[model samples]
Target: MSKQHEKLRMMLTAALFAAIIGIMAQVTIPLPLVPITGQTLAVGLAATILGSRYGALSAIIYMLLGAVGIPVFSGMSAGMGVIFGPTGGYIVSFIFSAFITGLYIEKTSATVTQAFIANAIGMLINLTFGTVWLKVMADLSWAEAFVGGFTPFIIGGILKAFLAAWIGILARKRLQSARLLPSSTKLSA
Candidate 1:
């Protein structure tokens, strides 16, 4: 493909991925403060597939849409205030999670198992930021914060990570077959 065509394809793909992530957020199984949603899985998958720049741009696009009052967040909530709310930290963490995961996946060599591990680390980053924000907002101790905001999501996160990694592997293979990715960009785990 031409350079312009490739750039356009990447942009459109990023936007589509952001939209998918937003949709996944709405298919939530509510907990207490934080809901169990497939958004993290989508985020990880986008990162793994799109690379760091595009992945982070996709997340930023999602956040911007939500900030503009798009009903894209969990429970269909949106706007700047919602982002600054108790769960805001988690939303913000998506940017870093996507960026870090993409960076690692792009730079390091990793198998499916290693990719899953990277996904887990990314989720932990989200939990850490989210738990801290929850503590401040809820005025709870660390233990309380963890129980309320992080613990309940552990199983779901693990499941999502595994799924994301698996999907990533599949997508990578397909891309390789299609010659979408240059061999020089390959990473080994």
Candidate 2:
């Protein structure tokens, strides 16, 4: 495909991934600090499949949609209140998580093991950012923040990270082999 075609494909893919993240957000076990949702899994998948810049762009799009009062969040909630709420840190952290995960996977040629590690690191970043935000925004103590926001989600995060790495690498390899996705297409300035 021509570079122009490739660029359009990337943009569409990013939008699709953003929607996927939004849909996944609906699968939530509502909690106090942060809802247990499939969002992190989708984030991992987007990063591995879309690469760093595109994955991060997709996350930004998702946030923008939510901020605009779109019912794209857990339990179909939306608006600026959600974006600036106690759990908003996790939402904001998604971009960095996707970017870091994608960068690591791209650099390692999307190796499965490294992908898992990268996703795990991304999860840690999310957990840390979300916890701090919870503490600051909610006026909770550090221990309370960690317990409520971080500790509660540890196992679920690991599972989602692993699933994202496994599924994303497989899908990416398939797309690459099909000539549907280029291996190294960075956005032009």
Top TM-score prediction, candidate number: 2
Question: What lDDT tens digits, residue by residue, belong to model 1 across residues 1-189?
Answer: 666767777788889889988999988888867788888999988877776777778899999999999989998889998888888889899999988887777777545776787789889988889899988877889999999899898888899889888898678668767866433443221
lDDT of 2 by residue, 65-120 (tens): 99998998877989999878899999999999999998887777677788899899
TM-scores, one per candidate: 0.91, 0.95
User: Which residue window of length 10 is worst by lDDT in model 2?
Assistant: 180-189
Q: What do the candidate models score in CA lDDT, each in turn?
A: 0.82, 0.88
Error of 1 at 15 (Å): 0.7
Q: Candidate 1's error at 91, in angstroms?
A: 0.6
Q: Lowest-lDDT window of 10 residues in candidate 1?
A: 180-189
> RMSD for each model, in Å, please?
2.7, 1.6
TM-score between model 2 and native: 0.95
Regions of model 2 farther than 4 Å from truth: 185-189
